[model samples]
Target: MERIEIENLAVQIRAARLEDAGIITRHRYPGEMGEHLAVYEDWLPTVFIGGVYLGWLAQSDGRVIGGAGLLLINWQPSRTDPHPLRGRVVNVFVEPDFRGRGVARSLMQTALAEARRLGLSTLNLGTSEQGRPLYASLGFQAAATEMWLKIKTEHGLSGDSPASNRIP
Candidate 1:
């Protein structure tokens, strides 16, 4: 593998191209390596379509070590507040070999800074059991238990789907 200088890492972080999807996806889903290539084929275009920001790739010796990204979410109004809109952090991943090396921390810090720069008042994310401690150390709290309910339709739900049915 080609050794990537830390200085080059910074430069690549700024100039990441869509063609780098393979590296990012592999880093994001390590255990499911068999599915990595396919997963990116399906999800990458949507990320671009949705305009989400994929974080920098951690490279060492020209190999991808980790990846991260943010998912923007709108907050809904609560009884106490008239406005409800917020951003969410998502898709944080670090390769096993790179764990504990501060790659994930650096990615997250960059993401949080970007979120703040975007003027988001609050950021939220759901975490796997393995990721909980890292998130907590970064000041993320478990506000509630998260659950997913999927409804399948031949043509998928229409725009008329009830607003309350979606996660906020």
Candidate 2:
């Protein structure tokens, strides 16, 4: 893709179809990440057909420049949301050359709009440090209450003991 200023580029956003699975997968994993990760392409069609996963693509001159997806995940109803389903924004990526051209922002906005149309009040996403500002600008606050721990049962354990690494 040619390096073009945002104003000079005319990007079009479109709904993703099941056939775009390959395109979306490339954008989502991109390069070596796909090789190291476990990706199940077979299940992608079901997500689209089932209407549980919504995706959008950004294109310029008929070439895809970016894409994003929202997974409608089932969760136990909580006091604040009282709903069994919520939205999880995923795979927001823009080509290196297309960075800073508002492609990612456009894709996200479309996903959010779809979520709203489906009456989803709560949304979540995991982002890199670089994506923090854009998400923040879009009113995504730091979910400070959330934490993660990756367990490796096959490898047993390594590094500091879990007890020794306690927050306290």
Report the C-alpha displacement of residue 139, candidate 1, in angstroms.
Answer: 0.6
Error of model 2, residue 153, in angstroms: 5.8
Q: What are the RMSDs of all candidates, in order?
A: 7.4, 5.8
How far residue 61's Cα lies from its native spot in candidate 2, in Å, is 0.8
- The estimated TM-scores of all candidates read 0.67, 0.81
lDDT, candidate 2, 80-156, per-residue tens: 99888999998899999989868788788888888888888999987777688999999998776877675667744
Which candidate's lDDT is highest?
2
The count of backbone overlaps in candidate 1 is 5
Which is the leading candidate under TM-score?
2
lDDT at residue 100 of model 2 (Cα atoms): 86
Reference-based TM-score, model 1? 0.67
C-alpha local distance difference test of each model: 0.62, 0.78
